[model samples]
Target chain A: MAKTVHPDQRYLLALLNNDAQLINEIYKKCAGKVKSFVCFNNGDANDAEDIFQEALVDVYNQAKYKGLELTCPFEPFLLLVCKRKWLNELKKRAVLPVTKEEDSLLHIGEDTFEQAEQLEKQQEQSKLFLKAFEKLGERCQEIIRWSLKGEAQEKVAEALGVTYGYLRKKKSECMASLMKLVQLNK
Target chain B: MAEDKITWTARFVEGDLSEAEMAEFEAQLQTDAELQQHLENYRQLQQNLRQQLAPDAVREALQQTLGKLNSQYFGHETQVLSLKPIIKWASGIAAVLAIGLFIWAPWRGNLYQQYHVPGQMLVAERGAASETELDKAASFYNDGKYAEAKSILEKLYSKDSQNAQLSYYYAQTLLATGRVEQGRELLTTVYNGESAFKYDAAYAIAMSYLKTGQKTECKSWLQKIAKGTTHYQKATDLIQKL
Candidate 1:
């Protein structure tokens, strides 16, 4: 059975579905409070906009990677995410970091906030995985990349001037090798 | 053994295993802890790589999506924050709604909706206007103090039982309070009697029927008012709506 979708989570689905109209609604309805929070905390409109976009991307990635399920209203969840991202930005820029939040945002339950942290952790993993991928051998990187892109094994072998059986074998070895490198990097 | 493990893990991740092989792979996954860990790590690597290695087109789309959000939040908001433009647009819509209500009001279907701006009654009788009970009732009615006006009108109505203005305005009070039956009876009496409010009373009765969800009776009463009468135009519009 299809799960009953919450209204707030509709924004996340819009991001996933690439529905421009509904995504536009997310900006129209929810960005005002976020802009207020950002501007009040020594940031400008540009900063707020950047934080909001990043928050949205984080939500999208969480839904894609961490199976993020929204359990509260979208506005507060979005506000919490934007606030956290802005504080992280502030910390990155060497500004005095914010520990407190607007009472409205803080009132949402712990898991939603934890979801934001989880997405950030996933983001860190992606960054690490990319760096480790670059350290891999050329054939290992190409095989992994092509396999992900859904390029046929026979076609990849043809392009690399190798047999299909050898390509699969090399691809497997590369996956195992890539995991080892990622583990070592961590 | 290591090469065999690597090959099977890759095929399993890629769904390159056939039915028998996939069944065997599932059985091994259920029992073999080390192979399960390898599969889990490979899956995680696949997820991270798929995300980080997003195609150039997908990356551009993501940027464009963010740009769309940026323009909506900041660009439009900056214009709205100017206050003058927002005020201008707001007052413009208000003015347009006012003109719209004035020019094309009667076609509004609901009786309560149709009766938004009350009819012009209760003319000031020279110097007797302000201090008189009639003026007090008019003032109360105009100010939306319906219950107060109804009390004053009912007392005034008992004194002058045949007064057209008294009957009409008092019945309007009843209608406003959702007492459609009482309002309809008073309207019918004024409509039948010789009074200046005869046409108006007919129209009010029609309005009362509409308020009571009796459109058919409302239409019949509305159709009786003559063309040159004060309420003929409104009545005609209401009949068409019915």
Candidate 2:
């Protein structure tokens, strides 16, 4: 089903385009809630700040890479992502009995919850892919990186001192190798 | 899997196969679960790689901007805000004396000066020649060397006439250097664009009016900044004072 693109997709666009004023609006309107949640939990203002920034970065990455579409208001969506992130942080720190906050009980929609889960999954897959990528030979890594940078294959080939045919053949082989490595790791 | 088969599968996932070969491959893939798995993995790799490896100047720019905002929101400014009521509760005699001193205070300077928070020019190309020149321009502009900043910005703006961010900073340099008409005109263009700078440009126009002591015009521009924008509070405050 084609989900209606929420008006708050503007916030996602702002993240992608690095629109400072709109981004500032995100902080101004949303940061207080995030700070309150973090402080009420086993966290501080600095912890909240870090979690907020990281969540925004995750949103940006999803928008840039996966074409993340927001179907809910950005505030609740952002708060949801921040809550999940803060919970994870608590788990990592082994903090016990997190205090309940009213803000954390935000009435988010099912679609928004699914969207946050998808973003988290995509981010985790990206980390695994990166881990596998680092295991590739330097030549394989270089070829794959250049090929995937949205440059023309011919231009990339020329820049890399290879013919178009050779670059294509090498790129295919490198990708094949990467897939095998990824499958093995999985 | 055979070496040739793996390469062929990878190439197919990459869309490197010709129309005839792709048609042939797709027909075979319906019954071939192993081929389907290989194809899925290759496709996933490409998507992940593209996402992971793409050059992200916007992300870098966003990080820098967030750092600055964090300081303002969570820094000493919060403490300063907490102290405001204390100032209001001072005795009437002390308040009168404070107002008398404030009338002569440099801190209570120009309205425009008090509120004109300049947007930092965060051009994302970190090490390019244009980026270096822009950094220099930003430095000069921040240091109040508007004339020097204006020269470099003018050259850049001419080359990239459609770059809204460049146009924004260029407009700021113009306004700073007393090129009021030219500055406001450029800012109008930014305000009309579909970027995040639209409200910022509006706020800049208001500041320019305040600079010229045009209170009515200033308030009108400030009114254009709707609620929920970063500038809305400042705009409303300015409007009330005006």
lDDT of 2 by residue, A77-181 (tens): 899888888988798779963666335367878888888888888888888888888778767777887777678989999878898988877888788888777
Question: Native-contact fraction for each model?
Answer: 0.38, 0.57
Cα error, candidate 1, residue A143 (Å): 2.3
* lDDT: worst 10-residue window of model 2 chain A: A96-105
Please, what are the lDDT tens digits per residue for candidate 1 over residues B1-242?
A: 22467568877776566788878888888989988988888878887787766443433465567676787678543322455545655665566457546755656655547643355344334332137678788778867777888888987774444568898999888778765556766787799877888988887787677766788888899898989975687678767766
For model 2 the local lDDT of residue A47 reads 77
Give stretches of model 1 more than 4 Å off.
A1-5, A98-106, B2-8, B11-27, B56-62, B76-242
Using Cα atoms with residue i matched to residue i, what is each candidate's TM-score against the true structure? 0.53, 0.56
Highest DockQ: give the candidate number.
2
**Which residue pairs of candidate 1 clash?**
none
lDDT of 1 by residue, A1-186 (tens): 644446678777888877788888888887888888888887988678868877787777778666777766777678777888788878877888544654544467665666566777887788799888877875677667666666777887887778887777677677767787887998
